[model samples]
Target: MAELPDWLRSIPPWAFVLGFVVLPALGFPISLFYLTVGAVFTDPALALAVALACMTANMAISFAVARLLSGPIHGLLHRRGYPLPQLTASTEWRTIVLLRASPLPWLMQSWLLALGGARFLPYMLVGAPVQSLVGAGMVLVGESLFQGNAVWLMMGVTAFLLGQAALTAVRRRLRRRGSAY
Candidate 1:
């Protein structure tokens, strides 16, 4: 809730971009980056592009961290009588979509999927776009608020609702099919 530091406001744009790519791994709130992008960038499309790229990079980093720690975490969990779920190929993308669409924080989703043995290709392919949609919505909403543009606000709201609706539809289908997430 605090305002960004004065220095942060003055940094070169490239530094902001670099921060976007690196800060989330250190527990910085990515939503801050998302919300701030609109105010910073002159072009909405460029803002959205940068936000998506940053989000994807953050996801990749989280996944790599999860991969590095997976063996130790898996062993620890097993010793404690808990085991991470193994995602089968058939259900992998579906799972990724669901988690990406769910309310879980972006970092958590990446970590969960990577820890669960999600393949890198599928994880990036399926998760990035879906998650990017969410980030795009945030960027839109941020831009709208910063610019006081009602149209962009509505678009952002619609994007968010559509994501939720898709998640709901997928869950219903899975339920009917007698499959559980």
Candidate 2:
């Protein structure tokens, strides 16, 4: 909750994008970046957008790295007679969303989903929107808290609730689709 350095405030926009990608991709905690984006960006919506884009890139890159390693790990484990977890096609989206929204640390959630057997491209496509919706709420809340304003706090709450509702609807629809197929 301490003041951010004046230098941080002066950071270029692309640095934010790169920071979000590199920090999270390397397994550094990302909530702080989201929180910093929340505190720094004057526009809550814009902050969310930046955070979401960075987070999406982080997820894709980190997941890709893990996924690339997984093949070898899978082979080794299989040779040793271990069973890897598998994600059914229908439940994949639901699982991804739930894990992304869960209270687990960001890196943990990403790694779990990466290993859950969802197709890479599909997970990337579906995961980005869900991450953005939830991440935007977090940024809004962070913005409100940093600014110490009651009105902003209310807006943050509203944004968070709306995002959750949208995510729930998405999850339900995914389930229904899963069942139908």
Candidate 3:
């Protein structure tokens, strides 16, 4: 990846805290990318801390975005000629939970929440720990892989991702069935 701009580096530590730390809480993808990159280049401890912090930020942002977009998102979906069955259905809680618990890409959840107009508070409440745990696990696996422990690292990451995918698929199926109730 290209180096962060010198101007970005020149920004005060507080700026990094606000942009990377605070903004990500709002479900911004940049934060996740930043955390992952940091994990790749830094020590595990730092990576873990950054991942936790990013997760916190993601929750805060998701909540605020969800709350604010509730009406607008509904309207936009209507205008865009898309079905609201998934978004407006009562399946959000389960869907969000499964998404959070899964090892699928973090951005998928963030985008779903953002675009679906899910409730911000609930999304954050559900998504924070899920993202954090997955992220930390990814970092740990990455570290091990970097250290030449390819078997363990590959196994761990594969297991986590597969588990997440299974859970998400099952939750989606259940949600679809529940919507018929």
Candidate 4:
């Protein structure tokens, strides 16, 4: 096992809680924290449990905030002569997931979906779990790093890459379908 970094070693529990909530909402990179948890803790299960909880909470809050800000943002863009395409209310779950999973910056995903009038249920149900898979892979990466095992590290990295590839494929398919009309 690896020694925990000094900052992470001394971090308080409340800090972890807050980081989980705020970091994702702000689109901050949190893999380090996830890695630290995986490295320092003796139990991989516990690390995963806490990491996922934080990720879920962060996604929930960020999604809600984007939803709340959507109207204002649209209005601002409209006034500035950049009218966004109004998404139909009948948008399907696949559409929502595909849009949310596009190859954009992390924070933009939330805003784009909210602006497109994505339903809260679908974002939570369809998008978040898939999104969290990446984070879970990240946690696994941390675990591997902590353990200093080449095989486990390679496996974790490969899984994360595969997940990324899958997301890219889904986004591309969605784009092609979207343009077919």
By lDDT, the best candidate is 1
What residue pairs clash in candidate 1, if any at all? Answer: none
lDDT of 1 by residue, 1-181 (tens): 2244334447677888888888876677788888788666748899898899888888888888889999999999999999988999989999999998887776677778999989999999998878877888888898787777898899888888887887788889988998876
lDDT rank order = 1, 2, 4, 3
lDDT of each: 0.83, 0.75, 0.59, 0.70
The C-alpha RMSD of each candidate to the native structure, in angstroms, is 2.4, 3.4, 5.5, 3.3
| Strongest candidate by TM-score | 1
Candidate 1 lowest-lDDT run of ten = 1-10
lDDT of 3 at 2: 37
TM-score of 2: 0.78
In the predicted model 4, the residue pairs found to clash are: none
lDDT (Cα, tens digit) per residue for candidate 2, span 63-128: 988788888878888899985778998678777777776778877777778876878876788777
- Mark the 10 consecutive residues where model 4 has the least summed lDDT: 1-10
The regions of model 3 sitting more than 4 angstroms off are: 1-19, 22-41, 86-90, 101-108, 114-117, 145-181
User: Candidate 4: TM-score?
Assistant: 0.78
Q: How does residue 158 of candidate 1 score in lDDT?
A: 88
Candidate 4, residue 52: the lDDT equals: 76
Off by over 4 Å in 1: 1-9
Q: List candidate 4 segments past 4 Å from native.
A: 1-4, 40-42, 89-92, 99-103, 161-165, 168-181
